[model samples]
Each structure stands twice: as C-alpha cells, then as structure tokens.
Target: MAAWGSTLWLLLHWQVDLKSVLIYLAVLLMMHLYTGLFITAHDAMHGVVAPGNKKLNTFIGTVTAGLFAYNYYGRLYPKHHQHHRHVATDQDPDYHGGNFFLWFLSFARQYITVWQILLMAGTYHLLQHWFPLENIILFWMLPAVLATFQLFYFGTYLPHRGEHEPGNRHRSGTQRRNHVWAFLSCYFFGYHYEHHDKPYLPWWKLYQEKDRLLKENERV
Candidate 1:
C-alpha cells in the first residue's frame, strides 16, 4: 500500500513533460504499481494477507479492491471462488475460450458495475479539483486501465488460454522458467500452474514454488 500510495502521490504532483522519457517510465511504473494493488487484493481474498484474522483479512481485501477502481470485494469474492470451482468451463466467470478481445469484453462486463463507473466519474471530478487534470488522466486513470490489461493478459488469458497438458487437473499452463521476466510481466502470475497447485502461497512466493516445481520435474 505504501508503494502504491507513494508512487501515485509523486506522479500526481509531477510536472507534465510529455517529451521526456522519464514521464513514460513513470507511467509504466505507476501501471505496475496499480497492478500490485489488484494483486494485493487478490492475495487478501485468498486469506494470505492476514490469516487467522478473518475481519482483518476481509478489510484489507476490501480496501485494496476498492482502490483498484471501486471494485466491490463482496461481489468479487464469490466470483473468484466460482472461477476456482468451475475453472475453464463455461460456468467460470474468468474463462473465455474464444478471441482475446471477446473474452476481455466478457470478463469486463461481469465486474464493471454501474456503481463503479459512477464512483470513478465522481472521483475524477473530485480529484481534478485538487490535482492537475493531465496528472489525473495520465497517472491515475491511465495506469488503472493499463493494469487491467496486465492482469488479464498475463494473469488470466495466458495462464488459462488454449489447451492444457493432458490430465492436468488445474487446466492451467505456466510460463517458461524465467523468474525475473515472470515477475516483471505479472508479479510471477505467469508461473500460473504453480499458483493453482498452491493457491495458499502469496504472489511473492510464487517464484519459490516455481523453482521447486522445476526441480521436481528435473528429477523425474
């Protein structure tokens, strides 16, 4: 949360300099941090953030999810569990075996509630009064939009797309072994089969799980 809040605060106050590469870099950084917000929420939903304290866990999840464009935790929690239960089947809220754009649309339709839109519109109006409009658009708004694509492409589409290994219970595929790239891409969520195999592990520990799985495969 500190990382996200600090980055956003810096960006919102930064002077506009479109010609500078630093501005672009900052936008990308904000985008990644925005992705972190959602991933943190995802972790909270899994009870990884504050195990043994259900209220604390739910509070953290609710806050992070709300930060990510006013998403409702109560709405997402059930759907996420449904995704786990139904997986790649038609019943899975996250699944779409067809085209990427089509699937993204389908996925967006499920979560993009009217309240979220109204809240965002209202927040945009309110923030613009306090922050530069361009900063609000470029840093705050743009990053959140980009972060959705990051989450969908690396975390959802790539991991669950197309055919899976025969008899794979998770119906998931992992990225090639490259922990650094995996982290940069989507917080190591591209090591996705490792995730479904061990949902209890937080995003930070996915690389360790990946390493263990790779070593196990090597010895086979």
Candidate 2:
C-alpha cells in the first residue's frame, strides 16, 4: 500500500508530460501497482493478515480492495471463503472447468459487481474536471482492468490450474521456483502448494516455507 501511494505521489509531482502520446508506459506501472494492492487484499481475505483482529483485518482488506477498483471486502469475504473451501470445484466462483477465455470472463464477471462499475464511473465523472481524461483512463481505469487479468492469470488460473504435478494437500500447482520471479509475478503466490498447505501464512512467507519443504523432501 505504501508503494502504491508512493507511486501516485511520484506521478502527481514528477511533472511528466501527460499530454504526450507515450504516457502509456506509466500505465504499465499503474497496472502493477493495482495488482500489488489487490494481492494485499487477497491475503487479508485468507486470514493471513491480522488474524486476531477481525475489524482491523477487514478494514485493511477493504481499503486495499476498494483502492484497487472499489471492491467491497465485506462482500468479497464470503465469496473468497467459498473459493478456498471448495476450490477447483463447481462451488468455487473462480473456477470454470471450460475454455480459458470463457472461464476467465466468468470469473471476472462474478467479482465485478454492478456497484463497482457505478462507483468507478461516478468517481471518474467527478475527477474529470480536475484530472486529464486521458490520464484517468490510461493510468487509473485501464490499469485497474489489466490488473484483474494479471491477478486472475498468475494468482488464480496458472497456480490453480494448467499443467502441474499433483500436490498433496490441494490439487494446486507451484510455478518455477524462482523467488524473485515468484514475488514479481504474484507476490509469491506462485508457491500455491505452500499457500494451500499454510493458508494462515502471508504471501511473503511462502518463499521460505517452499525452500524448507523442498529441503525436507530431499532429506527424505
């Protein structure tokens, strides 16, 4: 969250040429920032953050989720819990055992509530006079949309689906075990097996746990 705010601060005060046609590069950075923020909210939903304090945890989750694109954490919590409890099954709203694009569209549609769109449209309407329309679309709106794809692909579809070795606890799969790439890709969520086995641990801790588990396996 701090990094996200810092990026916004830089964008606001850095005096970049927003009118330039090449401002789309900043869109990539914004996409990443949005993805990171959503990942934080995802962690909170898993009860891996502030486990003892329900109010504080939900507060943090709601703020991050809303900032990503006006998501209500309270609404998301029940749905997310259902996903965890019945992952890769018909009950999991995120899982679609059909075509990739079709499944993705369905998954995204489930989370993209009507109120979210109204909130964003209303926000953009109010900010139009103050912020450049192009900047708002490219930096704010486009990135939020792209970030959904990034989160869905890396954090959900890839880790939970695709070709993978059969993990013991859950049927989830881990990506290539490069710590940097794992963190960069999905905030260490590529270690999906570790995550399912230790749902109480935050994303950052998954890397260390992955290594320790591998060492134990080697010893065996």
Q: Number of the top candidate by TM-score?
A: 1
- Alpha-carbon RMSD, each predicted model: 0.8, 2.4
Residue pairs with colliding backbones in model 2 are: none
Per-residue C-alpha lDDT of model 2 across residues 1-220, encoded as one tens digit per residue: 8988777646643445767655667777888889888878988998767888988888899999999889888888898889888878889888888777988988978898899889999988987777666667777788889988888888788867754465454768877679998877778888888888888888889999999989998999
Please name the candidate that would achieve the greatest lDDT relative to the true structure: 1
Q: Residue 132: error of model 1 in Å?
A: 1.1
Q: After superposition, how far is residue 25 of candidate 1 from its true place, in Å?
A: 0.6
Whole-model lDDT values for every prediction: 0.92, 0.82
Please give the distance, in angstroms, between residue 131's alpha carbon in candidate 1 and its true position after superposition: 1.2
Q: How far is candidate 1 from the true structure (C-alpha RMSD, Å)?
A: 0.8
What TM-score do all the candidates reach, one by one? Answer: 0.98, 0.90
**Would you list the clashing residue pairs of candidate 1?**
none
> Model 1 over residues 31-64: C-alpha lDDT tens digits?
9988998888898879999999999999999998
Looking at candidate 2, what is the lDDT of residue 95?
86
